[model samples]
Target: MDTPLSGSGNLPPKPGNRPPLSLSGLDFKLLRVFKAVVEAGGFSAAQNELNVGLAAISKQISDLEIRLGMRLCTRGREGFCLTEEGKLVYQASIDLFASVDSFRDRLSSAQNELTGDLNIGVIDNTFQDPNSPLIAALRVLHDEAPKVRLRLHASPLDDIERGIVEGRLIVGVVPVYQRREEFDYFDLYQETSNAYCAMGHPLFDVDEHEIDVDVLRGCEVVNHRYALHGDKANFVTLDGQSATASQVEAVAMLVMTGRFIGFLPEHFAAHLVRDGVLRALRPDLINIRTNLNMILRHNAPRSPLVKAFATALGVDLKAL
Candidate 1:
């Protein structure tokens, strides 16, 4: 007779029966407050964070529950706790704010005033190479997007490549040994390295004629961990490997100990050689030539900053 009053005793109508809520500015404000309250663990704890009084926050939460036609949280003696519906809403709020922030970043990028982060990963010792365009590209990025924050990480090639694939880095500069399908490689330049011995090593003062392949093969050497997989390993015999290093700097340290021989990029070794700190073992017989490349995920869309960097590096986008 009386339409059963919608749910038998004035309880809020079932979720399916209620009309959907159309979000307004006020709704956003209320949700923001609700988010702060939940994050702070209770209304009283959120006062300093929200900069509002307890009564005002309580009123806002009550208003939000009324507008949604659902109980969002429980408070008082039992302590603040979210209802099942409240938990779902809180999770959705997180995703919603992220999308909003992304939209803002997109708008800023479109206006040519990029103000988000640009993460770049590179293999160590690249800055010392006069041929690398990385320094010039960084200068260009700084001049153009002065507001953008540039984050640079120097690590091993394998770590750099992994960072690019996992979206932790926008771009990576590394030596290409074997190309992976996951990356779009843009050629940067080549580097040359030769085996060397430090000042205190036995061969540092040995005559060239006395250092034959057999003599070198019998000496202790340091092997690059990453180069063990391909032809790169074949450049120098690994039979004498008594130590392993992941970085060129580490290799230098080992070589300097006068107990191991290791390969180093010519440019990186030049100053050390000039200072009489190291001497090349046999450049003519033991050397490796590697092409360095800039890599990005083949499937991911390039960010504006990445595009700018590629342009600065003179990479032919059409080829990629």
Candidate 2:
């Protein structure tokens, strides 16, 4: 081994002999803030999620960067963007949090009663349906496990699927695209939709039978990123500037512009139809029936809260 000494020096410290940095001194709160900011794309954007003021979050992130001795991101007039080091840390943080969640779930399994948060994601505009039964099911779960916290997210199909897979969301109510071996899916119910046009739309004056697929091809319509490719046939997929909306309300608003024709849930469009704001075209031909499915991971041992809510949902749905 080389001597711990250098020329003209009695002794020199070895460069690689220092102790490893211990994470035990790190504040979990600071790390959590860092994670939130990373996921939220910036400190200001994550204020609500962190439930703290902007100054506090900024300080926490600064502390985290100091502790790690690395700059994670840049935020200013140019907007927020993660640095190269931030990307690596973000991925590592995801694994860390997922492991922590698994540990919590294992601890939960030791108890007989259900207690903890149960995240459920559903598509928008379905709550108005009396037959949806989400309200009834939530009521049942609330009574059965009063300690269980029921959280619902009315998000798009992409968020629903990704959230569940990542454990950010525990359950999802959505139209299943393709079956995944990792997930257990239950057929909940179905909703029917039809192509519609605003009163000022060109098709508004066209005869129902005459509004065929060929004519639809020439019309502009509001499209969704998650819209099934097969369902494209139902909407006359047009060529030109693509107008895509993630939220159902945004889609409805786009269709209401009188320039685009798009699909909307029949139940949701009922009021608009009655008000003469929109009219259905070729309902018999452009009809698309979507099957809503309840999705959850199969490999993980589900919390009692999940099971109880699922049971409640089934019971309530059956009553409908």
Candidate 3:
């Protein structure tokens, strides 16, 4: 059987093209059970969550395999393992359910009610800054839409950008230097970072007055993974020992090793700099000014909740 992972109530005129059975004849509970089994790892492991006996769970899975006319998994004392077909089916099921969820969210939005999941993706370490307005924006959104389920995730700049573009994320908070036409961005705030040298580094003991671009160009410096693209000219670099890190903490750790000098968000590096473990290298010339922006996909639907959240986010910063 070639089951249409998603289905309407009626079957097609050409039976060979799709499953002969219509969706109305199928029980969604069985698909839900199958999902639970996969997520929980096996029938025995999923018993509690599924609220069913082992025999029943096994029978349902067998029925699902028969319905689809394919073997989805293998089970034994060796434990459960999905077949190659099972992996594709699982991913399709996930996308199907996600679409259903989005459909429900759209219905809720149409009704002028704020309900359903709201996904927010942000780059790592924004919470460390005292001036960050994310918390305040969340509070405002929460008050306005008490029923909304907000999911907050911290990811790398690339992952955050992908999330927003894919419609998996409603909004993203990231530092913007390179803008994508697919997204509309609002400048949230300006953050300053500066190059730093660990205690044992040659530049660490160099006097502030003597520190210059030439001095920085003499040592090995770390760069962000995405920094090598556009804005490469803006970054201070040294010869021979360049390294890359995706996150600010990883960059800071690289700098702390005394092997590579790197830039860090001032708020993130403040404690270390204050502890005398590292020195901020020539703040006057090496300060990296970044405009942190809140972004959303240009094509995304502006739901009442999304608009409300954007309004709240922009009130203080005038970012939107």
Candidate 4:
């Protein structure tokens, strides 16, 4: 008679007890295929990502299920869905790969010279800051570790922070608006933003003295989503009408429409001001200053690559 099935819907044990599965090169390859399939959602969709035919992908999945003695997922007309066992396996695979990466980092750090990937994330628009030393830091990295691979990603501050926490990025440079316990922030520099108006705006040619809070109360101002104003920086807070933009570029685009006034970093607006495209309302009274920071995951292991990059950026990790 056929043996009974388990609660997991997996077939019964094959006669006597089986030996423990030993991972090999093929197992790793199969796991990678499994991961790609899961991330891509289904076999048909994963074809392009895995660069393999659907039949081969299906066969590999079947092989993985047979090797582990469990049904990892359900596919067919009902669509792709992970079994409870599959969910656990997927999570375990994520941890396993992270460990492997960490081991590689440790091994590279143990060597004499820095040789590994340093993924850096930065908030958008910082390159325009006249005081930014990012290029100088990059030059230091290049000079010190010519063999190291450098990768840069530009994103919003929140996204940059998330990337660091998730191990997708090693370091991030952004303005410190709200502090999180998961990160250690280092002071880098300061950036100041001032209220600005485009050439066609009514306030473009107004005297600096005439554009006060009362006057600004009649016009519409574009709000930057990540902008955090202090007690003294209420230029946009005491507004007449409000609009929102997430990026500085978008803020500049809105200001140029001849309708909305917005705030921008001094360096970012300098060229526009010189070209007669934008004007600062009142740099003395209508400005906000914020500190730019370099952040890293607080408890993450600092490989030599990370140490070298932090040193290049003038952050004393030992001090922290």
* Candidate with maximal lDDT: 4
Runs with alpha carbons beyond 4 Å of true place in candidate 2: 1-26, 180-183, 205-219, 229-244, 315-320
Model 2, global lDDT: 0.75
Runs of candidate 4 with Cα error greater than 4 angstroms are 1-23, 26-94, 231-233, 238-241
lDDT of 2 by residue, 1-320 (tens): 11111123222333455556566435466677777787567878898887888877766666666656667888889988888988887767766766666566567767656666787999877887655768888998899878777878888888788877776678888876677787788887877878888978999888777888888888887875565647766458645636887766787898888898887878888889999888998888887777888888766665556668889878232231
TM-score of 3: 0.73
TM-score for candidate 4: 0.76
Residue by residue across 1-320, what tens digits does model 4's lDDT show? 11111123434345477887798777777787887798678999999978989988887887777667778899999999999988887766756666776677777767767766687999998897878878899999999789888889899877888778766678999998878999998888999988889988999888887889767657788878777665333555444445788898999999999898888999899999999999988788778888998898997777778888888988898877
Better of 1 and 3 by TM-score: 3
Deviation (Å) of 26 in candidate 1: 16
Kindly list the per-residue Cα lDDT of model 3 for residues 157-249, writing each as its tens digit: 888887676555778888887888988888788878888889888888877899888777777878777544344345555345568787888
* Best candidate, TM-score: 2
Which window of 10 residues has the lowest lDDT sum in candidate 1? 1-10
Clashing residue pairs for model 4: none
| TM-score on alpha carbons, each prediction | 0.66, 0.78, 0.73, 0.76
Show where candidate 3 strays beyond 4 Å. 1-17, 20-112, 228-235, 238-240, 315-320
* Per-candidate alpha-carbon RMSD to the true structure: 10.9, 7.6, 6.6, 6.3
Order candidates by lDDT, high to low. 4, 1, 3, 2
Higher-ranked by lDDT: 2 or 4: 4
